[model samples]
Target: MLDISVSAKLKDLVPDFRAGVICYHHIVIADLPQIIAERLPLFYENIRLSLEDHPVSAVEGVKEWRGIFKKAGTDPSRYRPSQEALLRRIGKEGRLHTIHSAVDLNNFFSVQYSIPLGIYDLGHLEEPIRITVGTQEDQYEGLNGRIMNMENKMISADRSGAFGSPIVDSRRTCVTEQTTDALQIVYTRPSTPAEESRRMIKKIAGMFTQIHGGENEWKIIE
Candidate 1:
């Protein structure tokens, strides 16, 4: 386990904000598990149909994140939160291309719960992680390979600096097939009940271990 804390700055902005962190050790990473390969398309189509009659902005989950981003001084329409992005993709494309098992699983749960989920290789992180507002001076190479301007956005930072956010994650901590240890962060909506977050995190841990063969422990940080 690691020391993870929500900064006072963030707490003051979104009083009920909470996050669920799942830590995995010695987990095997696969390109694609048979079960996920078969199940992902179904999940994507289900979400697409569920949102077919409704715009992504009309979704309760997406609305919650839009509010959060506004409070953080971010323009939700410009840099949409990860959940809204995923939901919009499903609405437009009806399916997502497979990455690896870990990423695919994260995306599945993220869409199912309408929350932004981030997974990182533990080898790249430092202890005493803090979730706080980003600064103009803070920038890092995102998973997309471009320098991310994290200014005024909510972000997760270790001693090495910002590595993940509800919007995007830095490439420095991205998980690969060779990774053995990882951390999955659930950026829950402020109004989401604690019990619901717990159930989701537990489900994520159970599913990951069941598919990838590993042990995991999880906690909620507020």
Candidate 2:
């Protein structure tokens, strides 16, 4: 169980855009230990083999998703995949180091489903979180302690700080060992058909169920 203060705050932050969307799903999980033990190795191995067989092309579908965000008037740069990062992975034989359990789970799901996911540590967030586009001044510290480039981006944040990327969670709200609960938002571009996106969401949630012993609660938003 989570602290009452944190739980109440999480309840209040559900985004308005998430309402009535038939393609989006938010999944909450309670126990992550079992998830890590059962699924992490399989996910890592599958991702490694998949990348080895059909390596992600930096110039291909990488930018296709960006186009969707661009047409939506969101900053193309914020949503764009880092070409340097992609090339580096290719150069390194497409091997990725597994981070912590929660991070690994999210990364696995992203690679498997070709979708972006953001995980948040419920305890770290302040009450009344809001989902909105970022402004020129909005900034966040990301992986490796680097300041995120949020120029003209969108993010889910609260008075304390941002949690995810323009479409996912920022590192500030990332899960840790002490995390008792989490909220995950699967961002599906408008370009993908609603049915296809929903199917992908279910696949991801199903993986969570297979890994963690719990009944996940989810809702779809437009």
Candidate 3:
């Protein structure tokens, strides 16, 4: 198992911050299985329907995350949380194309629960992962090879440096078709109950293993 913790500096800034970590190992990754491929459209449709009545920013979960981001020193409007971004995409395009089995599974729950979820390839990370506030020097190549400035942002760092954040994840740790072990981080809102986070993690693990046939374990950190 990987060692993961939240730093005191970040805790002091956002006292209610909580995270759920799911470590899944010995898995096979490939194209989505038939059932998952078939289920995604309907699931995405439900997400679109859920947001039809309100703007994505007006969602209770998004609002809570905006507050958390503001407390953590990042402007929420400038760098929207991943869940909010996904919801907005679904609301606009009505669907998201599949990346791979692992990413698709994480995105499913991220949209369902309105939480930012990131799945990292464990093989690419160093040990002793810590969730802390990024320093001025913290920066990484984000999705699509774009550089993400991590200054003053909440981030998950390994020995290599900041690889993931609620707003965007670094490409270094992004899962690929060759990946077999992964760490999925659930960026739970401060207002979310512990039990709720636990249940969400459990459900994620269940769904992941169901599709990929792996063993997964999870824990919460605050």
For model 3, how does the per-residue alpha-carbon lDDT over 118-139 read when each residue is reduced to its tens digit? 9999999998999999999999
Could you give candidate 1's per-residue lDDT for residues 12-88 as a string of tens digits?
88888899999999999887767559888887898899887888999888899899899888999999999889888
Compared with the true structure, what per-residue lDDT tens digits does model 2 show for residues 1-222? 211112222223322223111111233334456645566556556555665655554334345546544543565554453332433353355444655655666666655545456767666767565545556677877765778756545466677756665354456777765555666666554556667766777776666655543445555553
- What Cα-based lDDT does every candidate model obtain? 0.89, 0.53, 0.89
141: Cα error in model 2, Å: 1.5
Candidate 1 wrongly placed segments (more than 4 Å): none
lDDT of 1 at 159: 95
Cα RMSD, model 2:
7.3
Off by over 4 Å in 3: none
Show where candidate 2 strays beyond 4 Å: 1-61, 72-79, 82-91, 166-169
Best-matching candidate per lDDT = 3
Q: In model 1, state the lDDT of residue 49.
A: 90
Q: Per-prediction TM-score, please?
A: 0.96, 0.66, 0.96
For model 1, state the Cα shift of residue 38 in Å. 1.2
Q: Considering lDDT, where higher is better, how would the candidates rank from best to worst?
A: 3, 1, 2
TM-score-wise, the better of 2 and 3 is 3
* Candidate 1 residue-wise lDDT at 83: 83
Q: Is candidate 1 or candidate 2 better by TM-score?
A: 1
